[model samples]
Target: MKKLLILISILISLQVQAQRTSAPEGPGSLTFWENLSKHCGKSFEGEMLNASENDQFYGKKLVMHVRTCEDGKITVPFHVGDDHSRTWVLTMEEGNLIKLKHDHRHEDGTEDRVTQYGGLSSNTGMAKVQFFPADQETTDLIPYAATNVWWITLDDTSFTYNLRRINNNSPIIVKFDLTKEVETPPTPWGWED
Candidate 1:
């Protein structure tokens, strides 16, 4: 009876080990998405990394707030001075593809004419960087913006939002210093008052 009990104990231990090693994991690996999601509820101040003197936000206060985060999605709202109309929605698709979409709204809580435009990364970029080319939705929304390509980067010190128009010399860059968490701005335009 002692030997039988020992064998049963070994079998139970092995089963437990196998279950621990093989059980499912949460949203396998959207590393870049995961990295960005880590800053939920934090706000950071940013400036244009490379900008022309006439840039829209040249002297405006730019802030980005990682407002909401869930298992497979995150919403980051970017504020330009008092304009609270831009929110970036990032979703982790079934296969772990990261889809970025811009949700723009008016102060009165209405959708904007030129909004919901973005794309998915062509490959599985590491936690530090990811590049997304203009997707069909983008092309359909804005004809001239069909060639847009965006670069989203994050590191221990900063988070950057960069955009390039293919075959066009102009590129817009917004780099936020992540070393400090700034005061949270007002709720975005479409959110509950």
Candidate 2:
């Protein structure tokens, strides 16, 4: 009976450890990623909530397509007016953190000078929100953007992408309505069929 009791306790401990590691709704969980993934393969139209006076995206048609999703990564193409030069890549890292990278390309399918600039999340953000401060790569590529911080928030009704430059008080916010699905835009630059 003593041996059997010890085995049962060991099994219970292992079970608990597994649950702790795999629970989706646990503290600092991957619920944010799961929520974002729910919209995989869908496209949504967005309105600019805020932008600077000279911003390129001002007064333009905004669209975001959740183009690709895999086990640990998602690719979203962000369209502004007729420009299809930007893609957002979200990757899950160890410890439930997510990294956001901006992949920029020219129409000729060549990478832009300021491509692949983004940062990793500091912690497992909430189910509906994740924040990524500019990483060293971004700072090195775009010196003025060293103080940039970008965040994405997703909820049942809408999803928002926002950016703030700490050094200057510049802000840009775009919100996409989840209640409606828009037509998927053409493949982003460099992602042609």
Candidate 3:
């Protein structure tokens, strides 16, 4: 009876540990990350809500693919028309922070002159929304656009990626409806076909 009791206790402890590791964090970014991972291996189409004529995303068939995911990061390729040169990278930072970076590459599998510019979340934005301000690298890369801020909102109906440029007022929003999952698009530049 004593040996059986010890074995039961050990099993219970192991189960608890497993549950704790797999459970999603709450009231902040962890929940959002887990929810975002739910759509892994899926692709969605987005439309610019307010884009200027000069915007690269303007008048293009915008598609986002959650292509690569891991324990601490997810890489999503954002396609604009035939320009498969942009990717969004989200990384888990210490202290409950989340990092967002824009990775751009060329068709010949080379890095672009302007790439890997993004920011880390400054607060626990919850499962509904997350805001990423331009990091130091972005400030150095594009001094004039240092004030760029990105806010992502996810809900049952839609997932919105909104960008606020300099002065944090001019909004360029791109939103995707969650109910409609589209066929996967082609691989982005520098990726295997």
Candidate 4:
């Protein structure tokens, strides 16, 4: 009887461990764009307040729109109170890191700003954004590149984006917290259910 009880307990423990180690299904394991597609027909309203210190555009309201695309892409259109207009493309890459390409443009077709190559950190949720010189001949742009750390969290109904600008020279730290706007009618949006 003792042997049988011990065997049963060991089997139950192994089963529980297996279940715990199982991977998450659906959006959980899907690519960043694929996960965003789950929010199709939904809208996520949030503000991108400026956290830049010693800048006149501090505390400005920057609206964000996260729209789903059929080609598996999340279009994040953002405007910072007439000061800046840009769009960030978020796509999943190998090793589960999200690739980010930021394009700052004016009303015209000309490119006002460009981030030659930007991507999210592989191990962290922080954004590794960089700015390059207009001249393609240049090989390095580290002196001009700005690194920003950002954190994102999602609940069953809403999501939040917290961005902090890292100061490489000064001791002053800039931080911005943005919470999704909750619709009264409870529209389908964000990573919420």
- Scored by lDDT, the top model is 2
Clash count of each predicted structure? 0, 0, 0, 0
lDDT of 2 at 100: 96
* Candidate 3 lDDT for residue 171: 70
What TM-score goes with each of the models? 0.82, 0.84, 0.82, 0.51
Ordered from best to worst lDDT, the candidate numbers read: 2, 1, 3, 4
TM-score winner between candidates 1 and 4: 1
Expressed as tens digits, the lDDT of each residue in 21-129 for candidate 2 is 6555564438768778899989999998766658899888999999998989999999999999999999999888899999999999899988999999988866666
Q: Residue by residue across 1-193, what tens digits does model 4's lDDT show?
A: 4554475359446534543565344333243234345554444445333345665445655445564454534555554555344655566646555555555565553565444334453442312121111222112433344454433433334444443334432222222222344222221222222
Residue 101 of model 2, lDDT score? 98
lDDT of each: 0.80, 0.83, 0.80, 0.42
**Candidate 2 error regions (>4 Å):** 1-24, 27-29
Could you arrange the candidates by TM-score from highest to lowest?
Answer: 2, 1, 3, 4
Checking candidate 1 for backbone clashes, the offending pairs are none
lDDT of 3 at 3: 58
Segments in model 1 whose C-alpha atoms lie over 4 Å from true places: 1-29
